[model samples]
Structure formats: C-alpha cells, structure tokens
Target: MYEQKTKETDQSVMEFIEDIENIKKREDAYKLVDIFTETTGYPAKMWGPSIIGFGAYHYKYASGHEGDAPLVGFSPRKAKISLYFATGETERDKLLQDLGKHTSGKGCVYINKVADINVEVLKQLIDQSVTFLKETYPSE
Candidate 1:
C-alpha cells in the first residue's frame, strides 16, 4: 500500500505545471516533465503532493533498510528543483561531469532551472539514475 497522499484536484498535470506561483520555476518543471518522459519513457506522476516522479523501483540495503522509491523523481522547490536518485554519489561521477549549474545533496540533485543547464545532459543524468536504481534493485 502507498502511504503518501496526492491531493485531489481536477487540475491536469499541464494545468498544475502552469499554475505554479513561480512562473520561471513552473515553466522549467513543465519542460522537465516533457523531457523526462520522453527521455526515460516513463511519464511523470505527481508523487505525494509535489514531486514529479518518473517510473519506479523497489530497494533493500545491506543494513536491511528497504522500501520502494520512484525510479527518478524531482520536485520543483521554491529555491530550486530537487532531483531524486536513490543511488548514492559514487555511482554518479561521469554524469556529474556533464551536469551544469547544479548542486548535489546526499542523493539529491538541486538545479536552479533546466534553462540554466544542458537539457540533454540532464536527461542523460536522469536516465543513468533510473538505470542504476533498476540494476541495484533488480527485485523491482
């Protein structure tokens, strides 16, 4: 069973993307949704309330920690877009080399706007993240 609750609204994803209070951020998220879906072949789903999640996977760690996380997800935060890749940093090297204008947090990638970075490289990063998760967590 899923614990996170997505809000109930008739608003379509496009509408929600356009209706974000921050115009620049809204546009960036929309563009990302489009590119992410196209690049990964996983359509965007509004996870929990705000995260734009792509695909999905199941995970269990050596410490017996386990759960299901979206294969690749991002949230358009007020300050920046938070890209979620449950995979840790060591596996994220070469892509990081090409990722521009972004900051990394533990397992999260924070970028100001897709416009400020190389969109193609960003797609590759996301794809790589998804692939890493799938390979690491093959049970899903």
Candidate 2:
C-alpha cells in the first residue's frame, strides 16, 4: 500500500519536471492541468514529485488500508501520462468504451498523450470517476 507521504510540495513537483524541457510535453502538462480544473471544478495541485492532482477522496480498502488521495490525478511520465481515477473495472467496464484508447491498472487509467484519446471521452471519464468517488467516499 502507498503510504500517504507529506503533502506534495510545489518545489518538488516543479523540479521533477525540470528535465522535461521538451516543449510538447510541457505544453501538454499545462493543458492537462487546465482541463482537469475546468472540467472537475477542483483546483489542480502537484502531488509528490510528478502528479498533478485534483480534488480529493478518502479510501479504505478491504485490507484496512486507508488514506485521502486526489479524486483524479496524473503524472506526465517520460513515456506516458497517468490518469488516476477511483474506480475498478467492475464499475468502469462499460465506461472505458468512451475513454478512447487507454490502458488501466486497478483504479488508474494511463494515456500516453491526450491526442491518443478523444478529449470529449476523457471528459466523460473524469466526470464519471469524480461522481463515483464522491458518492462512494463522501466522508472525504
């Protein structure tokens, strides 16, 4: 289980992306940040060293693991950007249809770039994920 580290710092997150001097990646990162905020109405904050997180959700797993995590977050990795969501395939089996081409891991969805996915579908994905998290983990 991922331990809740100290809240992510702006300096750390900024430094983590310092090497990503590629104009395209940097632009995409900013673009995604803006989209995340506009669509979800949750201000974006950098989480840890790389993730741009939005909103928040509390989760307690079946094994008793519990923590507060961003309702949706993403890290612009060197190879791809990760989209975080608080849902498993069971609740998202059909939801992925509209997500365009993307891969999943547990509650996260990974997209190499926004271009690979339909922007409109991505919006729907975020909307559904946020709704699911809000409804399922209202205490957070």
Candidate 3:
C-alpha cells in the first residue's frame, strides 16, 4: 500500500520557522502562524518537513487513497509562500478574487509576501476552508 509521507509530527513549528534563512520570509512565517492560529482557532503544527499547519482532517478518496492533512497551512519556500486550503470549493475561487496579489494551483495559493495580500481576505479564506472541510468530511 502507498503511504503518506507528510503526516503531522512532533517536530517544533517554531524551530522550523527559526530555520528559515530569509529574514522577510521568517517574519512572514511568524505572522502567518499568528494569523492562521487566530483565524482557525487551532494551534499550529509541523506537517511534512516544511509546512506549518493549523487544525487537521482525515480524508479518503473513492479510489481508496486516504491520508491526514492540515485544515490550513503555509510554507515559506525559497521562492514563494505556499498557502494550503480546501480545493474544489466554489467559495475558494470567490475568496481568491479579493485575496489581493497571489497565484494559485489546484490546492495551494502562492504569495510573494504577506504584504502583497489582503490579510482580511486571507482570514476569510482560512475560515471558509475550515468550515468547508469540516462539513465535507465530518470528524469523528
């Protein structure tokens, strides 16, 4: 059976943020930590090797692929900050329209910096993602 490598771990999220070499990205990581935690009402946790995630959920596909994932998370990559959210939600697209300067993929949003985006919209995105995930996949 295939396994998921990005399971949540006991690793220190603060240590991960401190290891970020870029000062600005480091600062943004901390800011995101606060923003995500405050918005989602969940403490941050380390996911995989790089993502700082808030809350969590278990998901199983119809094809039998199943794994645990964060409700919302962000990684301060070398090139950009990656924001994770519930994909395929219609409101996600609508929220992105007011999210200010950012790019996105199927399930991630890429931002150059926190300053380039609207923090309020980001909060809305976080809240909506959590609500959508909980409704879509109720936790036991």
User: Which candidate leads the pack in TM-score?
Assistant: 3
TM-score of 3: 0.98
Cα misplacement distance, residue 23 of candidate 2 (Å) = 1.9
lDDT of 1 by residue, 1-140 (tens): 44534332333567667768998898888788888899889877766667778887766769876666678878888888998875563647677778888888787889888877887777777777877777777862
Please, what is the TM-score per model? 0.82, 0.81, 0.98
Residue-level error in angstroms, candidate 2, position 51: 1.0
Lowest lDDT 10-residue stretch of candidate 1: 2-11
Q: In model 1, which regions exceed 4 Å deviation? A: 1-12, 89-91
**Of candidates 3 and 2, the better by TM-score:** 3
* Regions of model 2 farther than 4 Å from truth: 1-3, 6-19, 89-91
- Residue 59 deviation, candidate 3, in Å? 0.7
The order of the candidates by TM-score, greatest first, is 3, 1, 2
10 residues in a row with least lDDT, candidate 3? 86-95
The order of the candidates by lDDT, greatest first, is 3, 1, 2
Whole-model lDDT, candidate 2?
0.75
TM-score for candidate 2: 0.81
The residue pairs that clash in candidate 1, if any, are none
- The pairs that clash in candidate 2 are none
